[model samples]
Target: MKIRQLQFFFLAIFFVLILSGCGSSSATKEDKVIKIGATAGPYSDQVTEGIKPLLEDKGYDVEVVEYTDYVQPNLSLDQGDIDANVFQNSLYMKDFAETRGLDIIEAIKVPTAPIAIYSEKHDSIDDVEDGQSIATSNDPVNQARALAMLEDLGWIKLKEGVDPTKASEKDIAEYIKKVEIKPLEPAQLPRAMSDVDYSFVNGNFAISSGLKLNGAVYLEKTPPHYMIGVTVRESDEDAQFVKDIIEAYQSESFKKLNEEDEKYEGYVLPEWMN
Candidate 1:
């Protein structure tokens, strides 16, 4: 009886060891998997259409996760729920990560569409009238860009010596055109077009909502940092997967897609592409 009991115990130990080994191997394989998160739209399309194929060719199992809100992607990335994200510009990502105490960094800048003043009410920017309302994002980074663009168009004047990157409605020193600025969520700007005289629409939101970049009354000449970037945790900076992702964005295939695809029409090409 004792001998039989010893044999059964050793058999159980062997099975447990085998299971443990299998689990360890599965984890090792999973480390090669790359998961990317993006807002549901152009950025997600970028991963599915542009980045995924290239990385898969290199033998990485790539999964793209889509989020609707701006906050969740970074939170997911920070918590290791996703490996990378491809929605936000460098400035916005930097500010967000800093504010949330998340350690993330942009791996590469992607070709981006520029935010623009879209108007259903006017045919051109020259048709501007005083007291008309323009919709803009309430977020500081984007609102600053919109306000600065208005300033550039001679419609608004920001207070002297204010940082243009951080400018807000409160910083408006004068209303050159006396237009009311309506601050809304970035995604809501596209829908607000019919009600407002002009709405500042983010590029991703614009493209996702079936609006064309060329159809805008005015498009921004996007700054380099304002271009959307692929972000990963700072600890992953030296990882092989991160390097592969960077290579994928810089690949000729991606450039060709952007050049030929009607979906990407009027997008501001990154400096590297130019």
Candidate 2:
């Protein structure tokens, strides 16, 4: 009787071990995998450097897809090539979707990096001499932002009722300082700072060129609508994967990266995250 009882006990322990192994395999199989698409530079770095590890800790396999062009991230998301994208801000994405007919939607706002005007020759806008040259991006979107920054700086007055998003050089109603507007490629603006009286530099390009945000003579206060977000397909908005991404983004670790890292310097966190 004692020998039979011992054999039964050993058999039960063996069965339990097999069941535990099966459970572990099931959990591994259930791990969610998601891919995010973003442009090169800070946006990509935010994921690859920060969010990627956090999600991995939660058993998510995260893939960050990078694109150099502005158009393809939305196109890829719309076609299900990626689960999400983190490239353009809300306003630009809205304009891109309306024009391209892509059905992408903003899921959650990410940190903002604003357009800034830097002056190497002048301490302030008031110091700019009359008829001096100021350079801005030749691209229309950035040029519009540069114009808006100039208007806010009181250097020029845009036409009354001119939409800031669509404003152009022709929309300048008055030159407060008689400064000439020189449109140049955004990448060249950082280098052009020495050449022009003042240069409008996009945030990412500025950071890459070793320009510090603290050195800007003027920086635009980005509106909530101008903040970047995790853009996703309408169909995937309610998915648990989407929630996981947002949670990972809003984590304390993510905030710490912006606070402690030079790469994320001058990033403005979303109001909701605050």
Model 2 per-residue lDDT tens digits across residues 189-226: 88998888988877766766777787888777887766
> Per-residue lDDT of 158-215 in model 1, one digit per residue for the tens?
9999998889889999998989999999889999999999999999889888898889
List, in order, the clash count of every candidate structure.
0, 0
Q: What is the alpha-carbon lDDT of model 2 when measured against the actual structure? A: 0.83
Q: Which ten residues in a row have the lowest lDDT in candidate 1?
A: 265-274
- What's each prediction's TM-score? 0.90, 0.79
Alpha-carbon runs more than 4 Å astray in model 2: 1-31
Query: How good is model 1 by TM-score?
Result: 0.90
Model 1 pairs in collision: none
Q: Which segments of model 1 are wrong by more than 4 Å?
A: 1-24
